[model samples]
Target: MSAHTTASGSTWAPSSRKPPLRARLLRASWRGLPAKRHDIGWEPGLVVPAADGSPLVTDHYFPRAEGDFPTLLVRSPYGRGLPWSPMYGVLFAEQGFHVVLQSCRGTGGSGGTFHLWRNESSDAQATVAWLREQPWFDGKLGTVGPSYLGYVQWALAREAPPELKAMAVQVGLHDPYALFYEDGALRLDNSLAVGAGMTYQHQGTGPFLRAMLRLRRRVRTAVGTRPLRDGYAPALGGGIPWLDEVLAHPDARDAYWQGADPGEAAARRTVPTSLVTGWHDALVDQAFVQYARLRAAGCETALLVGPWDHTSALQQGWPEVFTESLAWLRAHLCADPSGLRPTDVRIHVGGGQGTWRDLDAWPGQPAVTSWFPASGGYLTRQPPTDSAPLASFRYDPADPTPSVGGPLLSGAAGSRDNTALEAREDVLTFTGPPLSEPVEVVGPVSAHLRVHADTGYADVFTRLCDVDPQGRSVNVCDGLGRLRPQDGRTARLTVPMSATAHRFAAGHRIRWQISGGAHPRYAPHPGTDAARVDATEFTPVRLTLHADSALLLPQGAEDGQEVTAAP
Candidate 1:
């Protein structure tokens, strides 16, 4: 350790002589982080015993001049190197908290096989037990991390000890089933991406990058395989039995997925928790579910939503995320609330000009507005008087509609120009007239449709897009719903288009896109009752949309005025 003098006239020690320069650079990259209060020391390769007496590799980061600071536990399946080491271990430790960055079982040289969510709860309890025995343990603890790390925090909170004072779950996942399946359809791309990541990410960066590239190159072949379960094997660098198991069990009620969801953890704990997520994150809905559960259980919780996808939330949005997280931890653990925000909900509104807005709670009392899809590809505010068909399209499972953009785990995630996607024959679009004034939507978005499908077994994919004056249609938020045999005889269904806080600029058109499936993003419905993984035959389904269908949006104005659609 080397002692360094700060501009504030205090002497602090860096974990290693070389880390100060790297730490300084890392701190510089993130804008507006609170000033470093102490220097940190890193202890690597400490072995913590798991519930089954297995050795779990862990790293401890502590302030050299610490005086009973709260400890922050970050457990991850990803390797404990690069970003994890400097980001969580060094940064938070420098901010006057001890950070225990540990690798979950079978990852980063930890013992035992990784059984996904099955082992997290026991492992978390064991780690805390170990923490209690440490000489420097102050009995005040907090938990923070992103993605899988966030999931571990939830697992720990399920039976959190009194010492666990605060938690910050950023872009986290609580339900493994929800992460892999949506509306009865398997999220093919997400499953493959997660498969590759969990398998190779812990090995090192190089292997993970190579595996991701390999998956990208072979994704089409994998997605188009005759037996869908066997197709992803090649892309994932040989067979991942767990991936196959996940695909085989699409129903969340299956025994295989039982106990996978730790969502009940939120309702059972009253810890001051801060939730962070992006509007376009793959797990945005899960975050909302967590918020709802916490609120329902009367827990102290806060939410921060940005205009970012899953990965970008940590990259581009780190400044805001870090600031919010640090404040929450400080307020709860250090008994300091000076840096906390006045409101519990903060969101970044996306549009021509992106701006941040704060509210007492999320989706607080927004007015529900309806826009009907009329014939001739027009979206109108008035409902149709006649019960006639508005549009029709044929969906071929062999040539499923390609996904353009929205929440996905891979690099191809986020909003994209949808000019080519809209031109596809398998897709139907209804365009609203240009808006004379900006129409802001700030809550849950849903599309209620009355449709008939030639094949009883089908899927309905709905998307909300913003068509700019330049004719660029970029997806805002979208969702998919699986239709059953009973639905073949004209079904009335509501497709949850997730949620969003977006502003349609003046002159921009609101477009509602309907498609049978978004291939790869979702496993294309085989147009039969058989499970997609077992279906060897494919069928084409003809879908007819009724004009009575409407897109429901929770619209709100900044000035408390009514927002009307253009004539």
Candidate 2:
């Protein structure tokens, strides 16, 4: 485990078969140099028996020519054809690595029951053992995938498989609590969408499911209804019961979450990992938390953050992201880091700093700057001395503020034009004057608000926005905090907004939009101590924000002098 065998030492078997037509063309293009791309062929339905005696199905892809090669494995439930294998499995095989794309238990062509994370660890261990028995496997192996695919890598790494040399994980959500729920509020839209997709895939894409998916408006309407647990019964056809199980457990404290969470297995990890994520991705925050935990356990890790959402991280113009992954694999699996970008932290800064920055470490201890709310809808660096500077808004559960883009999987995800959202009377906005010079805020942001609600319970949502000279307000980061019954006393809510590295230009202003809820992204609070999403009782609650409330921003150096872009 101390060191991997060199690339030359590992490939002991010399290839005697002729290269495929595509490999020949690539060789011709390289003019006798090592070809980087080649044609690949796969053997379908390789039955690998799991520890439970269930057969796990996989498609193994390799270069057309016969030879010993390092293996790259991917275990996913999204099927093994088209997008999953054709896009990644074939790509790696063409690069001289044998790729194994397996469908999870009870999914695609695999066997056994399908319950998330229950069978992955054992199945993965058995599969790795099976690969070593194959004649074509060289001694090196690695894993790669994104989202759930990424989660599988982490799950298997927890088992500490000896052949598991390295991993390339992108947007992986190992914590089920955070994945399904946030701040004790259910992520309505995301939970429903994932369940619908799984049901469609698992139960066969029948006419009913296909028709329901096409009519998205009906889906949104159903999500808005009370008794959220049973709302999806019609669309899902009574299948994929996991959604209700998640809603039943309000937070991470429950034991149900332990099965899916990486748990103590993370400390056992010896595999070097490369993590890729986007600033706007729903799981970006969790991705960073996982990296920190792995690094604390003395594992080698690197991070790459882009300006993409969950979908764009894989589908959009993000080739450089995967290129970084390839380099990481080559370094650890093949012991060759040539032509590879150095292993370091890379981040994409938004808000007019349209470039990437490489750092020796994460932006060190951001200079915390505190900005307070002033009268007449304004934000100021100076605290309000006025004894009773207070603002009030009426929040009716029937008319909750709608979601407008930020860390969501729905179509309306990522930053969007928030001009209309900011204009709502129910949403309190405190704006600062145009900055005299540009300022960079590059770390976690939090807001401290002393709030009082007429009702026993309420939900507080805070957003950070950049107001351009043309009056367009775009969301940067936002978070939600639920307040319990104060019993006639004011409650102090410290809402920790998402982290970001954005710059406000000289002519732009900073704004904070405070509301009671962000529906669909988060279920609307029912104005009671019971945080259940099924309650439909609408109570109009008057909420007050004390002038002492302030936004804490982690600012960079004075002026933008210290902020530099990587070449």
Candidate 3:
């Protein structure tokens, strides 16, 4: 082993070295190896220093009678010991690969401060360089993790390190812009939920700390407070400071986001990647964008999307996520072509029985299906040939529309019932009759709206829902688009809803919801379009939705098969 002094004057060990006994055993316990599985030995707190002299904490598990073997690297800000090391580490190590779970800088027992994803690429490269020098490393490294853990892999893959082999990323964020703020709207609930965790984790774990971190309550307070800046910073305790940094730049065009984008990182990735996410995962849109970019870049990639939200994605999926990932990792990392795995894009269709379907390519080049707004509150296949009437609504920001369901991380997330939400006066509903035949809308859905607002600015929220036999409006996918005063005389709004494989059953009705807001799903548009934006106090804006406004669905669309229209 060799050591070199960093600029910060600490001697950096380039190989696994014994950590203090207390540090090694703290919160780390061993479970007996599974019968007939590889008997693995554990080493906790194997400190690897980053280039800047920050100690990065890592735990390693290896087969008892091991020679040099391939390594599975999982880099995360979450603590590296116990739960993850036991759940993932032992499993991978049992499969004949060494598993190393490392806490990112400033997390667990590591040194320096964790600044979300800012330092992951460099820290990961440094770890790999150190891992290569270790006596047991066989020059092959595969990465796995869900959410933030998975994100670190993408960030590091951009470097194209020689030792890096394969990646299995589940429900990870590639585009910070999309993850944080989508189309100039703050993803209030999700952002604050993550911020709350980052805040509590940064502070030392204690009963008081846990009390302070009562994240759900804090997020509720944050959502209720106005102007966002006033609420999020103070409530989150100024730890995990990047929350404010992201809030500072609400748009993707901001230069602050360029470095963290997965689109840019995709161009540099050379490894075979397995992309797993849920139809309702907040970052599902980013997942599709990432898959397309990787394929266009000619990198070997696989995609699996299911009908699940962020938390549920960890466990639920049609083919089972962990097993599919294991098969993928084994195929690429161990060079074992497991024929049990499907080699095409797979998605679980909603509103139907949970059955997995494989497609040679993604849902590409589907026919454009249009649903136009007609008399009363109905969505029809036939366009209005007569004088088009306008539907009007008053948008009161103080009493904004509430979010009931869909792809959110916090506060009523997932496909929850929206029957009560649709009955609100501020919400405009355009419901279609029962489908005579099942319609499979298996790709991106968009809304084209022609609107004129009496106020300077307004926000448009659109949702696709499946109205079941008992009159339950279950959300499928939704999107929000902000209409600024500078837009034009008549705003032509295009809101791109998330992608989904949903089969509208023969008896189910297709419903489209148009609302002024989705509450903290988006920070309620302050009903203003001034040089200085404010959401605390808002004006009542009269918004008119022209009959030209239409909802666009994917291929295999139905025409002239409508019956009842409900207001």
Candidate 4:
């Protein structure tokens, strides 16, 4: 080990030993990852001052072999230990790239308070300036990481230097408001999960685990509180002021959210970018939005969507994620196009025994199919002859409808059996008969509902489910919309249920579920003209669905006849 001091007066000791056993084991575990090309060298706890003179803690890793290599910058708020070090620092270094893994302000012993997105852009630029002065920098740069780490990349990309080459964002988040609010309703559970993660994740593994456990155990009581704002602090071990701020603002148009989204960076920059996300990841829609903006800006971009959730994208899907990211970095940053794929978009189709599909672009021209809900709980190609209501359900805030498996931030996310959830009286299910042939839904999914609510203030939760032959209803995609009081008449609402690339197998039946709300997943509608977070009174709401309501799906040809709109 040899110690060297930087201009910032922070010393880092570089080791010339072989890669740690953990890093080697992790590499071996990911069979698809490229073979290691060099021994590893690393320096820990190097201080890089932020633009405002706040010290930012950083760690550097490089290949011991004699060769100039491109540098990959990874900034994270999730601590600089296990998983990150082995995953990014050691592994990428062994692959012949210098990796700089830094801790965000206020976390990992770095100075300055962590105000979420407040200081990221300036800190990122500061790190790059420090990189320019390093003796090992080779002028080529790439950025990679998941979630908040990905956010930092977008922050820097807005004003990136000429040396910045490629970026790979996996299951990343660009808009914090979108992550916490969907259409006007607060995402209670996701907000709480994010609160706990940001508050304790950087402390250490044990503390983070304990905090999560504490959150899990107390979530019920917390969500059940009279005033919704008071419920989460106990579960999180303390009050997270940022989370409180998020809860306070339910409208995305609020000025509080200004400058919070770095999505504009994608539209402005022409950087070659690669995005990875899962169909069930909580930020899957945000990833799609990023890709769309990048492509619209004429930037060279690629997309990889798997069949996993946010965390699973880094766990079970690590091999594929790592492989895709490595290929993108090598192709753009190292000028190695040999490893690049022929297509720009790759998606994992979900159903029985999932399969991968490559396409020139995402969701290339799928036929729009409409299915109408008829009386007797049937979803059919024919329009309803009756003008009467199709179904009705009552939602009680005190006993709000429970959320099932979906794009949640917790461990209980992704596709799970929705058998019990569909059985609730508050939930209405419209099922189509068994498919004569497999129906492939490959693009955006949405619901056009004409509903009448007894209370002006209510919510509509719509979900798409795949019902197997064995009578298992599994969630594929879902969306929630907050309803406001209108004159005592029917209201037409369009609920965007995100997107999916799922195959409803031959034996599977398609089901559309509608309910007043998916409690906890969304903060329950108080059924009164009052803000959900501040509402003290809980009121029950009766919502009736009209026969004219329809489920719109982007589908590919399956059988000879197409499922067209009813005349």
Candidate 5:
């Protein structure tokens, strides 16, 4: 293990072994990383432009051995100093290629101030260019990551640099506005955390930090007296619509969003790519659409959807996920023994069914069965003969439903059903009868519903769960919809259900939950002034489930594709 520091300008030799920059960067990183039999580590490179025309920081850990290793470049807004890169970094590197992690222009030891994703594209492009110039680099490159880290890949891809051979983006911020706001409404929780966290991370983090602190205190005071039912947004009381600041633009073609379309031009090039997502992932649609678009454009792109939530990609069950991803990368950037052109797609079987299957493509030729909503908290095969007394719940923006783990949280903590989160009243639950035959639902999941709100604008959150005989509602997948729904055409939109391939056993039940909001999972849509009432006012919304509403199944798709089985 060798260590080299470019700090204030100094490069070192480790134990008399002189390695090239690429090997040095990765080896340095690997040496310091926590080691595990299943884990891999290495040093690579980071290219940062210095203010005084010197060097910024240029040592990284690309994931493969030196000598023409295909590269996977990751440029993160977070500190590369953090363990996240080393943890996921080395694994990808050892997957038969080079993996590189670099601190963004301003974060960590890299020189510069972080302006969110604004200036990241150039740094990423430069880093890729630098990587291509290395003796150990093979010139083939791809990018992968989630959230802010994922956002960087997309930002750089818009430029479509020559060396960005391909990418595998998860839960990325395609449209900052869509991610942050809902029709001018801000996601108070995300706003608080993001603004607060960044402020704390910055030097003096300045006014943003001070203001968020004060607002937090006010919010606590507001929610303190109200029953947990009054809701929690205004209670936090802060200024500047962080959501408004970012999500003001919802159109996909908007210059701001289109300029940095993470999907980039992978389709136009012969870039072989793969997309990773969870059934309950909020960004499922973004990645799904991108994967579809890339594939349609003749790029050798594959899609892999699982039942795990946001962070589950790193759990004990992630081996299969990584396996397929490695195979995909290996086929494209490394080596492939199978004459197969990297089996087109892969998905885990749904309904507690474990195993992976391959297919010619997504939404495969599958027999789609519809499960309609019944009157008495039941989701049945037959549409209700009588419109059961419409169940109603008070959706107070202040105390909306809290997220208890799911893809919507991007695998954030509350995603799984390990704890008893279903006990809350705000969460409306619907369960299906035990299965008579094993049913495997694969591919993307979607919720089709006719929604109505007393207010002009609204937010719809949905979750699909696997209920064991023990009555344990283990969340399987979830999706969110922010609606103004002013146009009748837009209200009937088909959103990608969190992608999953699960098999329901002979007796397990399927559950679907609909609620107004999921904190942190998404921001709340605080009813406008047009709606009356305040502390006592709760917006009552009635959502109608139509018999025609059905989950599309890619029937006949067997999980034998060149993909990995999900946990």
Candidate 6:
């Protein structure tokens, strides 16, 4: 069972007599995928069966590509085989898989418009239907992908593809806007970097992402390493349009984004799933939401949250993630297990330094709770005396607070923004004394406060930071609440910050900053000037962090399950 071979492997032969027209057309369908060439041999070409033209599909088939292997289906947005993702397709090919490198629909050779994650569910379902009929396919399929690609698997899983046996969704998105555009602000930088990387790959950069190799024997340095001159022009063209689309849409509710939301109904089920994540990952919260929701809904799932980011795992080699993944595939698809661990949640914990542990569920159990905040700087049980003046800070749209961390996508995406950028009068900061001891705050951190605007609409955003012993402020988490509380400012509201399991070292302090914008994800209030404006306008006015205003985090727990703190 270990050495698998495709039914059409060496047996595929050209016949002496001319083939029938329908047979020839099926073989040469201008529809499915084109034949591919790989070093091992002529790579099995595309495998799309005739379907409604709407089922645009692109894929690479390996005839016995994996030695005695089950199929490995990777629907990637990043052109497959790019060294950036560590030669994934080529490696799987070497592993004896009838590996299929799908270019999704609008991405590679497949024809269609790219709309992020929404339309992919139907596409994935149709793709499975085609692959199952392939002579080389074993009627079993498993999917793997990261980031946008990971989100694709999630959308597909919602409907539970009949042929889809399992999946490894790495850094996938549960909520598109939450992951990409937070609080209405544009995180232009990181999103651009991702776009650029994918662009470089799509144009077949093998020749150019590697033009430097041509210099080896000559011993002379290449005159230039520019992207265009190196053959990355096509990739650039491919990515630039997508990038432009991102910038043009400032509102999360834009029609363009609605079609890209993977987390909607498409990702609600508990398909047998394995998730990979990290404590430092800006995308960690989304994974947490997915894992918790899916598990609660009764899906057999496994989580491996290492202490890494978007790219670090591939470079450093977390064998556990990969080995366990293959084991999951084997158990579900190939029906094999060579000595695997079965615990559901595998976490690399921080706070008391770092280590690994496994639990049956996430936030696996109960946790401690503490509410810390104030009209001024304080983390006490007592509310600030009403006699004391309420805290106030100015928020100028021209000088809006730049973003930092916590489920971000732009340069100023997820992490805490430069305190220096925010300290410029637009942000209000309250700092407390260093912790008396190591304090583990591991759950959803939230803020409840009273806010006001000179006009009818306003938005309030909150960020939590860990001030080090040296007095530097590092962001931990943040949340946003947009309000049209003006003509009738609503009563005090509690905004929800994303959840996290973090530690405040004995010597570290905590800081809370409240501002008005994160942008592109959460629309910034454009100030109360425009009466007919939506909630995205900025509204300037005095803000009050009521005497009872505070930030609450669930505390120390054996398992990292989430807890909604009650006052």
List the RMSD of every prediction in angstroms.
Answer: 4.3, 5.1, 6.8, 4.8, 7.2, 10.2
After superposition, which runs of candidate 3 have C-alpha atoms over 4 Å from their true positions?
Answer: 1-36, 201-213, 237-240, 317-319, 386-389, 530-535, 556-567
- Against the true structure, candidate 3 has what lDDT? 0.74
* lDDT scores in order: 0.86, 0.76, 0.74, 0.86, 0.56, 0.57
Off by over 4 Å in 1: 1-31, 557-567
- Pairs clashing within candidate 2: 227-534
lDDT of 5: 0.56
TM-score of each: 0.94, 0.89, 0.88, 0.94, 0.72, 0.75
lDDT of 4: 0.86
Q: What is residue 224's positional error in candidate 1, in angstroms?
A: 1.5
Which residue pairs in candidate 1 have backbone atoms (N, alpha carbon, C) closer than 3 angstroms, thus clashing?
A: none
lDDT tens digits, residue span 1-567, model 1:
555453344455444633435555765677556688886677778899999988999988887773467899999999788678778887898888889999999899999988778899999999999998876677889999998888988888888888899999999999999999998898988998899989999998799889988987998899999889888888889987677778778888889988888878646787889999998899999999999889888899999988889999888887778888999999999999887877788888889767777777877788899999987899999878977887899999999999987899888889899999999998999999999999999899999989889877789999999999999999999999877876555898999999999999999999999999998999889988879888889999999999889999999733332212100
Which 10-residue window in model 6 sums to the lowest lDDT?
219-228
RMSD of 2: 5.1
Over 1-567, each residue of candidate 3 has an lDDT whose tens digit, in order, gives 444343334443343434334433531443332232565656777899886879988888766542455788988776754346555766666667778888888877789977866898889889888887776777788888887887888888888687787888888777777777767888877787777655554344462256355655576676777665777765666645687687777767778877876555645565888888888888888788878888888888888887788877754342366666776787877787763244457767667664566666677667878998876899899886743546878888777788888887653668888989888888889989899988888789999998887875888899999999899988999999878778863688899987878889999999999988887787877777531123557677877788888999995422212112100
lDDT of 2 by residue, 1-567 (tens): 122233344433323333334433433432212345656666667898887978888877777554456889888877765456545665677777888888888887678877767777888889889987876787788999888788788778887677888988877767767877877888887777677655455333464357446537467656666766666666555646567787788877788877787734754675888888888898888877877777778878888878889888876634666677777898888888883555367777788856676654554577899988888889999987853637889887788888899997656778898999878888999999999998788878899988888775888899999999999999999899877764354788799897888889999999988999998788878776655666756677888999889899998622222335331
- The clash tally of candidate 5 reads 60
TM-score-best of 3 and 5: 3
**Over 4 Å off, model 5:** 1-47, 50-56, 61-71, 88-100, 129-147, 166-178, 181-244, 247-258, 317-326, 334-342, 384-389, 409-428, 455-457, 482-496, 529-567
What local lDDT does model 3 show for residue 534? 38
Question: Which lDDT tens digits does candidate 4 get at residues 1-567?
Answer: 666443345555556555456666766666556778887876778899988898899988887755478999999888888678888998788787999999999988889888879888888998999999887788899999999989999998988888999999989989999999887888888888889889998898899999999998999999999898888888999887778788888888889999999878645778899999999999999998998899889999999989889999998888788878998999998888887777788888789877777778876778989999987888999976765787898999999999988998888899989999888899999999999999999889999998989876789999999999999999999998766665454788899999998999998899999998887888888988778898899989889999989999999622222212110
